[model samples]
Target: MRHDLRPGRLVAGLALILTAVVYFGDAGDAWQSPWWVAFPLVGGGLVVAGVVGVIARSARRRPESTPPADRNRAT
Candidate 1:
């Protein structure tokens, strides 16, 4: 079976992994500071936004078909 991932999902997954690293790595005392939380939060938010953008773009790119009423009527 083949699996395909949307751009947004890919980005979100990466952001999630990054968040885990930041939370679990415990780099130093600095990382434990409140300000350190901002990094992963911002990154995750951006990834989510990216996913939304990808979905929106894909929706817009779909072909528009003539309405059924118009198709049956004479031009």
Candidate 2:
């Protein structure tokens, strides 16, 4: 699959990575007794954002529909 890094995608990825690092690092343990909770929440949010970005991009790129009469008309 071709890799296209849109701005939204990049931001999502960054958010995911940041959260992962925090969740795995000592800071996460200090912030919360359990790391699992924060990890999953942040990771899931990032995934959702990424998916939304992809869907938004796809919708933006979709071609507009034309009526049957317009399709038959000459340029």
Candidate 3:
């Protein structure tokens, strides 16, 4: 079976993965992160996801254009 693409989910998933990676690195002492960094990261991700969803929905809702009929074709 085939499924429709969802950009919002894709962005949200990527953002979550990135957040986890950052937190994991910090926990392992690989790097230091400010305590409140995740807030903006997740918030921005959600906002971007929402915008993408809206755009995708609008694009899908638009009617597809058809090519003009040819009048010179032989009968």
CA RMSD, predictions in order: 7.0, 6.8, 8.2
TM-score of each: 0.48, 0.42, 0.79
Cα lDDT tens digits, model 2, 3-64, are 65576666677777767667666564655546466667677777777787888798766355
lDDT: which is higher, 1 or 2? Answer: 2
User: How many clashes (backbone atoms < 3 Å, residues ≥3 apart in a chain or on different chains) does model 1 have?
Assistant: 1
Give the Å error, residue 36, model 2: 0.7
- After superposition, the stretches of candidate 3 with alpha carbons farther than 4 Å from their true spots are 62-75
Off by over 4 Å in 1: 27-61, 66-75
**Model 2 per-residue lDDT at 3:** 61
Compared with the true structure, model 3 gives a TM-score of: 0.79
Global lDDT of each candidate: 0.65, 0.68, 0.83
- Best-first order by TM-score: 3, 1, 2
How does model 2 fare in lDDT?
A: 0.68
Model 3 lDDT tens row, 13-45: 888888888899999999999879899889988
Task: Please report, as a residue range, the 10-residue window in candidate 1 with the lowest summed lDDT.
Answer: 26-35
Candidate 3 positional error at 69, Å? 26
